[model samples]
Target: IRLRPGYFPFVEPGFELDIHCLICGGKGCSVCKYSGWVELLPCGLVHPNVLRYGNIDPDKWSGFAFGLGLNRLVMMRYGINDIRHFLSGDVRFLYQF
Candidate 1:
């Protein structure tokens, strides 16, 4: 996994998390854009403005946020070639998971 700088309106310090491509085992693949890495998460410390908006003391408290790319994770785990399969209403593919 790797962490790289990122941006989000609600977060002050954000990072993008990436993992080695499972489909090609870090060699290369279209899924990874031939970079051998697949983004897994976007996470960061909560911005002070967000905390203040929630009536929390930004100076006295801090928080963080993260979102998991479940579909991507599953795709990497199962070597699925297309992400649309998850959105497709086909039980034939959905049942496998």
Candidate 2:
């Protein structure tokens, strides 16, 4: 796993979490875009503006947030190369789960 700097609207010092590609075992593959890594989530400290908008004192109540790519995680878990398979509405694909 690795964390890289990233940008997101609701967070300050945002980061993107990535893990070594499971499908190809870090040898590189189309699913990982040949990078040997697949992004799994975005995370960071909550932006002060967001806290202020929520009527929370940012100075006193700092927090963190993250959004997980559940579909992506599942894809990696099952070695599904294409994400469209999950949304295709095909009984063939649905039956496997």
Best by lDDT: 2
Q: Which residue pairs collide, candidate 2?
A: none
Off by over 4 Å in 2: none
Clashing pairs in 1: none
lDDT of 1 by residue, 1-97 (tens): 9999999899989999999999998899888988999989999999999999999999999998999999998898888988888888999998887
Model 1 lDDT, full chain set: 0.92
Question: Which whole-number lDDT from 0 to 100 does residue 41 have in model 1?
Answer: 95
Structural similarity to truth (TM-score) of each candidate: 0.84, 0.85
CA lDDT of 53 in candidate 1?
95
lDDT of each: 0.92, 0.92
Highest TM-score scorer: 2
Candidate 1: residue 76 lDDT (0-100): 82
> What C-alpha lDDT, on a 0 to 100 scale, does residue 44 get in candidate 2?
97
lDDT of 2 by residue, 1-97 (tens): 9999999999999999999989988889988999999989999999999999999999899999998988888988988999899889999998998
Task: State residue 11's C-alpha deviation in candidate 2, in Å.
Answer: 0.5
Residue runs of model 1 more than 4 Å from their true location after superposition: none
